[model samples]
Target: MRMNFGHLRGVHVRVFVPSSPYFPAYAQGQGPPPMVQERFQSVISQLFQYRIIRCGGAVDDDMANIIVAQLLYLDAVDPNKDIVMYVNSPGGSVTAGMAIFDTMRHIRPDVSTVCVGLAASMGAFLLSAGTKGKRYSLPNSRIMIHQPLGGAQGGQTDIDIQANEMLHHKANLNGYLSYHTGQSLEKINQDTDRDFFMSAKEAKEYGLIDGVIMNPLKALQPLAAAAEGKDQGSV
Candidate 1:
């Protein structure tokens, strides 16, 4: 069935159920039934209505493109509303990560990032790049930062060229970390020379995140109350 998620920029979310006679039955516990699949899609649609975006797995071109599109579309829908991005990535492709980081800053709506698992390398950079005073992490989440990794394989001249490009990108990334985390460029360089890992509390201390979310329930109360007030005021 085609479900029109009108609130999510009119995207049509399709839930395809296998009609083949060979399809396993739910009674045999082989897979979820069609109704369950539809419910899963509905849950995702509800999350979009609240402007929640998930950046999970690796930071790559496809992931970055989808996130940037969502951010821009949501901002167009309501610039005043905040966009909450949940990040749980191992980090990949500095160029792709930069695209996402830049779009987060370029959009009109504030982007609040929450780290739920591991935010390493470029993932850490993006988490730290969230709107000031809005970056957060769960108590057990981990964040890591390090110098960009380069894989240059070619003739000597080509390798040299790639090395130079990598160095340039490294400098740019360090500068951004310094700016966002209020750390000196020298400090950032020193720390990132080796893999630097931080728990949520340590990340907050290092200025990578504004706060560690200790109590999920209490943490959501303020947001829920604010939303409630807005709804009543609108009526």
Candidate 2:
């Protein structure tokens, strides 16, 4: 069976499924429960919507794939539309975070990140990477940024290589921070040398976010203004 679902930025979503051999059994209420099947279908339908992407737990490769897929989908369907990314995470695999961070930068859509709870470490990196003047944090959200960490196993040579790699990652992250937040590499290094945490307002003051949003709709007003400004500039 094929199902046509909701649209995101005018992009139609379609899902396809093959007929089950036990269709008669299901019709007779002998296969899976109707409620369970409906719930499964509902979850699948939600995947097609691209207005928002949630990062609620640790940011891993699975989450990275979802984030990237949504961004690419949106870019393909409507490159100029704005997409919201909601982040509430304690941070996770640096590589996974980098995948998301890099994809966000590469995509054509303007990603507006909203930090709803905690945006720590790599999560903070992503929050800060949102399009300039579009990064936001709810009034009560917490934001944090810290140095990258690594663990090594096996021979001494392997440990040495891991140590060097960790240093390289640290440099990369610091450079990212500097570029996104308009901070210097020296300042980012000093701030991230330890676990640094801040309130939403403080993060805004520190340039980690453009503002602390009491109401997200109000925050979006700038996007319209920005668009107008761009049009005026190009004319």
Specify the highest-TM-score model's number. Answer: 1
Can you write out model 1's per-residue Cα lDDT over 1-235, one digit (the tens) per residue?
Answer: 1111011123666544323211223435556778886786687667778888878766777777888888999999999888888888778778888889989989998888888888888889899998887788888898989888767778999888888888888899999999998999999999989888899888988989877766566344323222333221110
Point to the candidate with the largest lDDT. 1
Clashing pairs in 1: none
TM per model?
0.79, 0.74
lDDT of 2: 0.72
How many backbone clashes does every candidate have?
A: 0, 0
RMSD of each: 10.7, 11.7
